[model samples]
Target: MGSRRHTWVRRLGAAWLAAAAVVGTAASSAAASAPTPTKSTAGPTPAELKRVDAHAEKQRERLRLPGMALAVVKDDEVVHRRTWGKDGDGKPITRQTPFLVGSLSKPITSTAVMRLAEAGSLRLDAPVRRYLPWFRPSGPSADRITLRNLLNQTSGLSERDGIAHADRFDNAPGGVERTARGLAGARTGAPPGERHEYSNANYMLLGAVVEKVTGQPFGDYLRKSVLRPFGMDGTLVDERDAERRELAPGHRYFFGHPKRFDPPYDASGVPYGYVGADIDDLSRFAVAHLGHGDAAARAVVSPAGLRELHKGTVPAGTSHRYGLGWRDDSFEGERVVWHGGATPGYHGTVVLAPERGLAVVVQDNAYSPQRDELLNATALGAMRILLGGRPAAASTDPMLDAMLTTVTVTAAVLALALLWSLFRIFRPSRGRPRGRRRIVVGAAVSVTGLLVLAVTAVYVLPRQVTVDLSEILLFVPDTGWLLVAIGVLATALAVTRGGLAVRACLAAPPLARTDPDAVRDRRQEARAGV
Candidate 1:
């Protein structure tokens, strides 16, 4: 079944590529008639890159981030790029590593759909039910949900009736069918196209449609049509299962102790599967969009689709003016086209400045508090210098970065010291060993660590960092830190409890020493020595 499904996706993907080529040809002719942008190789300078690095680091620190990978593009070329911090386990991260780009898949999917449209195989404004007669939104809303709405996120429908659940049921056997059934029977919060609401269900359903229309699975289609053409060879999709190729682990903080990065798939369990790409591959994607497939000159999106994708399909400010697959808006008076992606343990944001011929992509294994603000600020500052704008003030949040450095180093030192002390104290004493003394010391350290972690996670850290709903703490917020603290405390307590249990057994009295049975008993006693 999987093989058959993949075959269908491949055929559709080929058809889409053929269509993209035809569209590219026509668009190129048209672009020749339009006004050209001022081009430059003098992208953001090294000093600007330095500022960006510092700012991104601060954002990482503020959010308790494990690691981040970034790519900056200017005039169809990679002007700057970097990887910062550690992997899911605080192991250092590298630019070649992959991090999940969650809903960012939507734009890629939309682009493929547009290629189909260019082929005259589909239309954006068509009723989705037309393609799949079995597909329909629940009740009266059925007639209102269009392909355009699904792309723009203004569809009056949501997955699971707006209720959240833990498992990735949408990807399970018959999950897609069940989800389609749920939507067909579901109700909407707003009238069709009345408002824009981000819904994963929208894209998952779209994935199914792409499959149905092209007779291919989403991932296979993406690889053949998008990734291959754009040179995003390092990009990965649907990491529901682990694969070792260039993947980064995801993580979340355990309550009072240090933030625990999770195993790759376990780290951040995203509902829908995602596309994971390294910084360089992502930059290539950015260049494709900026270049729009003009091999001689650089461009990614077909100019017509790119323009349409940027046009506000939903009302501006009604819900961030969602377009075909991306969002369009003015950030600090500069027209910015971008999207933000979040999956279980990972957070990412991509910003593109069409006028400046510049783009930025930021990906983190764990959520970063600063997010696009610091990255965006740094990008803008760099652009200012390049464009000869007035010098901006120092935005390198030194205090936050310094504090984070101190905390991390101190924690490592303390943990190592504690371990060393524990090994010494727990070792059988050369003479007059006291089991009770060892227990007392272990319990004291464990309890003290737990208390300190609780204070930091619950009060100190949360107070110290600025928490925002739309930022890194979107899902858990107060509860996330609380969960982390509690998990840590529980682990510490478990260790102490095990030690105490061992102590109890060792402290028991011997029944007999002379008998062979007594000797056997004595060996057990020695094995359980305090």
Candidate 2:
């Protein structure tokens, strides 16, 4: 059983690695072949809008999405706005239906921080401790972290640390402050400002900083300073407000099927990932960011401040850069400022091409870790259509359905094998092992291999995916529990085999063990059995 489970796990790993390689190659080739962004003064034509709508509907049906909302804005006007499918309540989704816009909240929070800076309330380059004297993490370098470092995600906090504190579902008072203070126990992978490591902890501390400086809750200040000015009237900064607006319950994929998941409000995560908005609300925010004669956009932040917010100050990857809250990158060689966000059950993306005076906002009620890239493609594909280019070929959904199916079948086989092993260990033996020494050695090797497999599955695999086991369990319960089952069954099998080997050694005949001919005969018998 241990050997069989090990083989299954190895096969799963190999499949994942191969899939990743294929995706990487496809992405690189797409980028290389993408045409340069063309500056167009005209908006998307009616036929173009039709194509966009058709594409959205195709994707929704193909992915079996529960609900979705999309809006395309040109200059200061929304040229196209549409919705398809139903919400958790079975009502049709609308422009005003609130959906949790995960890390898209970062831009709004960053906007609030910039407003404070514009009024001389705080300095971007100043150490965080300058404002919040209690601000201190474990490392000495923590003291040198500036507001800018957090904004650009160069505060030295790793993704692992962020996942550790994320999705806390803590609705209690002072959760944000508590999360910030709790970082005193968190370890940093690098010194502040030395590397760009995205972490929700950075924005959590920023939320605390906002609270300390403004003497108001992070939500309150963000609404007054950012949302209101941008005409995002349908937006809500916290769970209570979202509930009042009847925020649509989001969905999580279970074996390729969408299941409703009404996750608890994470108050501590609002600044980084939990803000809620509808398509209309996001469209207005996009228009504001575009800043092409939109008075609301001009009034909220100065040209200099807006530029700073979209500037790529730190490198994130080969072609991507992290700005204050936005990601500066290219879509088809066209410069685009964008950000995509996800929680347990929702996915959303906002893309802005200021040069072309175009912006796109796409939001869906369903989300899954495996479908993250595919969901993001919805927004990118829309942008491509608007840019008068054919959208890139759609990639596969990362084979999540296949992976989960394999896990299920493998678990069943392992369970049966474990049961058979247990029965063999307890049932009356047909005969004692003639090669007791060989049996013991083989069992020892099996136990050692099983233990190594268990450790790798429970620990190393999660790190390779840049998350912890807890996160996997929280987001992908089926996969997580199946992994636990495999490890447990392997251990059980190891114990049973070891016990049988020990019993054989104890029952062996001493004369047979001392005789070379008998030993050879026993070895032949054991080989035949094997």
Candidate 3:
């Protein structure tokens, strides 16, 4: 009986082994037929790129800008480039179209400073007095000024020092120097380190320092030290060169109308604004911000110097910190460095997400009060898309729209009021509403309008914008002059009507009629203000 049981067990074990062989053969065949998986690649996803392009196009259309260019950089290369609309003259915009990337000039200017420092020609912490013996601000802390402070905009020089026009760039005696020297008695914010104050004059001053240190014109020094090394040959340092490029027309946003303006040569503004470049050339700049690798590695500045250029030195007015030439912010805890610019007819931005190895540059040929916002929106939106996030909605401040509406309505209302005042003065007074208070009110409004106009349109506004009334007209056109005209006209109307109202008030109570009830009736009418 035991032998018979052993034989049955051996037979069952053989059957199990045969079934295992069949399963293994089938598994091997399936594995051989399946395809192998490849590695995930770097750069923005296709969906993300499409979304960025759509957003750029949407903004271009919505704003009706003359032209626009966009480029994205990832892992040391531009993975995408795009252009939209046409030149102001209806020329098709190409990637080579130059945009006057205003004040975005600061980063390149600051980069040159860093290179100078790396070459032992300058020091970041040294007093401005060390390099620019001529920089004399009215502030008590003037000697406390440093090169770093100027680059980070904490030197506290006010916009009042921004040279009002580009002629300062000319060869006139003390032309640009005169503009820089104007900062000697210029006002400053808090002492250098106390707070952040954004001023173009700070950089304009640095441009002088660069000129002194390099013994070259600011543009020539920058071209040799920074642009040439970075292979940014397409970058034009001269504002005149910008005019010669396939440059697009610039437009001014006036109320709701677009008024085209001749682009000016802002020579004194070169250090802080007025540099122009194509999207392709600017992609090299975006790549340079990536640090330590790739095509931009050929630039003269050491990696350490490049890193220093990005350090947050002070609080930027926005949600970022102002570094050398870069504005520093964070995206979902990752580092974001960027700058934006708007000149007479252009708005542009360049952004870098170092951790993600991504950057974006956008430029358009249109000027508006909200131009900075338009560029910033595209930059931040591009960052979001590159970081695998849905682009945030464009941030147009409703208050700006409301203010523009108010300007239009107030202008219309002022016109009507002026007309009514004239009617009251010229029309029959025998049978009509008559009151000294009405005329007084009209006079008071006129006086108030005059005071408001003097304070705002003449004094405070020009100081705030660092441009005179004429410059304002050149940039914004029509709107400013119209406002000034209304103010002048309103003041005249008020004076004339107010005099008549006073004369009516003082006139001998309509002669009292010489009747017994005449005195009483006149007194009653005077008391009742009839």
Candidate 4:
């Protein structure tokens, strides 16, 4: 009986082991057949790119931008080129239309400098004074500044000294010297090489140095050395050349509508902010950034030099580093080097992700207070398209729409109040005839309003940008003119109200001034029918 039980146990054990083995095999096969996740390293799909178009269109509408042009380069080749607005004359903008690229000129200027260095004519670490003997930094202990300092914005120079933000040097050639001398008076903005304070004056000196050393007009040097070599024929370094090239007009907002301006005349800040190029020429510019230049591109600057141009030299912000002229950053785990530009009537941005083999350039023919973020918004959207991500949101605009709305509403209210003051001046008041106290209050308010506008225009704005009444009138017509008009109207109101208050005080009722007893006798006499 015991032997029979043992045999049964052995048979049961064998069955269980066979069943377990079968189940394990089935599980392994199921796992092998299940889907496995793989990382995506592909360019945008056709549908995805089409979606980017709609996305860009939406932004243009939401921002009320007049027009825009964009180009995308992938794998060192132009993959997409598009335009989405009309020129100031209502002509349709094409990829060939030129727009002023403001400070986007910096990187191109830096590229030229890098090439000069490779040619052994310039040194990145040399003192700026080594090239231009007239450049004298005021601080005795802070006399040291290099070409790298200027490119990285660590030159300890301020945008002030009445040069960078001022109207473009209306004069040329000869004027470049006079304007550069003015920079000699510039105070140190920071300890040299300590921190970054973006100053167009830094690049101004760079351009001057380039011209001095090259013995050529800075514009001519750029045209021959960089633009010509890269086959960017349509690009113009001089504003005087803009009209001959058939460039697009810059538009600024007036009463929330686009207003075109005549071309600007200044050239003092050209190296820092002004270069006119169409999307096609700009692509050639972008191609050079990828370090895959053809023989022609390589001839302008060696690939090694190009890489050096992008190598980070200092921290720009938390995640960004300022290279020679390019700004380095990591976006979504990928390296990106980019730059942005703003001018009176135009705004633009150019971005490059060398590791991903992509570049994007965007230009807009519109300017508004909110445009600083708007141009950035448009550029990042294009980057999203190239990187297989959806362009969903915009950059954080601190005060464009909000400040505009507030200013508009305040202007409307003030205008209406001024009209009411006019009515008060002519029409008599009821009851107590509004005491002198009311006029005093009105005058106080008018004076305060005028003072605020004046302080902001003269003291605050010039600190941020070199601006005068005339330029403000053209660039920010709606906001700037409203402040002026309101101030003038308020001044008039104050004078009128103050004069009325004094007259009212002098003309107080004579009867009320009489003695109380005399007033009682006159009332009694009237009741007696005298």
- lDDT winner among the candidates? 2
lDDT of 2 by residue, 1-530 (tens): 00001122234445545533442243211121211123356888999999999888888887789999999988878999999889987889998888888888888889889989998999999998897787666675878889999999888876666766778877777888887776655666777888887788788889999999999888888888788888887787777886789876788777678888886777778888888898988998888887643456567777678778887777876777888998888776677888888877788999988777889899998876666667877888889888878777765444555666655665676678778877877784786446666766777877776665555556666666666677766666677787677668767766776777777777766646667997798899999995
Across 100-191, the per-residue lDDT of candidate 3 in tens digits comes to 78778888888889888988899999999887776667675978899988988788765445534332435333344556776776767678
TM-score of each: 0.62, 0.84, 0.81, 0.81
Residues 151-236, model 4: lDDT tens digits: 88888875444233444544466444556666875678677898876667777788888888899877888998988878788987
Cα RMSD for predicted model 2: 7.7
The residue ranges of model 1 lying beyond 4 angstroms of the native Cα positions read 1-42, 89-91, 139-141, 159-181, 240-242, 254-258, 261-273, 292-301, 316-320, 368-530
Ten contiguous residues minimizing lDDT sum, candidate 1:
1-10
Task: Kindly provide the TM-score of model 4 when superposed on the true structure, using C-alpha atoms.
Answer: 0.81
In order, candidate lDDTs are: 0.55, 0.76, 0.66, 0.67
CA lDDT, candidate 4, residue 453: 47
Whose TM-score is greatest here?
Answer: 2
Candidate 1 scores a C-alpha RMSD against the true structure in Å of 16.8
Q: What stretches of model 2 exceed 4 Å from their correct place? A: 1-41, 138-142, 292-297, 394-413, 423-432, 463-466, 502-530
What local lDDT does model 4 show for residue 71? 76
Indicate the worst ten consecutive residues by lDDT in candidate 2: 1-10
Off by over 4 Å in 4: 1-44, 161-166, 169-171, 433-474, 509-530
> Candidate 3: global Cα-lDDT?
0.66
